[model samples]
Target: MSGDVVVPAHNGVRRGRPPQTPEQADEVRARIELATAAVFTEHGSRGLSVARIIERAGISRPTFYRYFGNAEQPLHSLLTLSNEGLVGGIRDALARSFEPVQLGIAIIDAYLEWARGHGPMLRPVFAELHDPASPVSGYREEAFDDIRALVRAKFTELGRPLPSPLDLDTALQTCEYVVYRVSAAAHPGSEPDPADVTEARLTMIRSVLVTLGNRADVERALTVPGIFDERV
Candidate 1:
């Protein structure tokens, strides 16, 4: 039978054929994830439902179920996308730096840029992920592990020893938590003044750098043109 052949609805599956090609399947999944992000941004995860996703994506219930077993699936996809983008940004930034401090600045600058750009979608997604009861917490943990590995690699590349009291894993985790809390605070609909939020982010970056024994990097990062002045 052709891939487009419609299958009968049974066992709670939707009544439609799957996408005919891998590309089509990918497109459908992207559409659903985008719709899911939009819905989650406007209405927190608690408000997200399979019906709302179907309405937003113009897909049927079974189609959604075919692509995702539950409402969290799309959110998980969004989180995965976010994590990939972040890792990509960090890697790109690190490529442009030679010194450890420069690497630190690059990472912070890239993170702040991403946080400001995707704060809306990230806010709700992370809030849900941070919840112990969330079904997709594994995704969050995995993403963090990837980030931690990247950080450790950067430090190793610098050839600079980490502070005596700080292990690589703990320091990376601390930095990650700091970024998470800062991004959460800077999310849209929180602080009214963008300047204040921007300052708060700068402070967050500076504090994290200091915690990592990179105070000089904080100064260099803040001196970068448009790093602090731009409104998120």
Candidate 2:
């Protein structure tokens, strides 16, 4: 008498048939990735092992390999997920406004909000990005480039030329400094409201623009050459 094989749902107990849907696979992968991130944050990425992930995730040992090829892949996914969420804020800021000063404020607010939302995942990613020896050290360079390209497009639309000493890379680095310092002050983990964070970020942005003499630079960067080109 042949029946069917069963798969476990919770606490390592078999309760259902095999997962056959893409959604199911994605859900499983997400759970495993989250578990891996939690463990890695506690143990460090290099210290994580397949056996430990299985133990931490409460899945079978082979289940770990079935989802992620190895520990590093899931760890990377977690970091990427954290970064993606942060980037989403930037994307939102861009969508919300074209005025450089407003956009700058939006960028700062978005960064602070992301930190408040994902402090656990971000702490390690932030630490790794700053540490030259960490595997993720070079990752932020690509992120910076992406952001600069975005800013460049905005500047071109505003009929402003890129300023001297404020090339794409330098601009990104400057933006990154704003994010890091604001995030540090916000202490998302302890903050009761994001108002203080937002206020602090606005003040910081004003100071940076004044000190760098970028107020005009920002205005020029956001000037649209044609009315037809404006989306909103």
Query: What does candidate 2's lDDT look like per residue over 52-137, in tens digits?
Result: 88877788877778878888888778667666776767777777866666666666667667766765555566666777766566
Q: What are the runs in model 1 whose C-alpha is more than 4 Å off?
A: 1-24, 163-194, 214-232
Reference-based TM-score of each model: 0.68, 0.71
State each model's C-alpha RMSD to the native: 7.8, 8.9
Q: Tens digit of lDDT per residue, candidate 1, span 1-232?
A: 6578766679867767553698888998989998898888888777789999999999999889988999877887776777787778877888788876566567777776666667566666556666766644666677667766676677678886644335544544555565566656653766325665566556655555666656566567667775445565
Per-prediction tally of clashes: 1, 2
Assess candidate 2 and give its TM-score to the true structure. 0.71
How far residue 209's Cα lies from its native spot in candidate 1, in Å, is 2.9
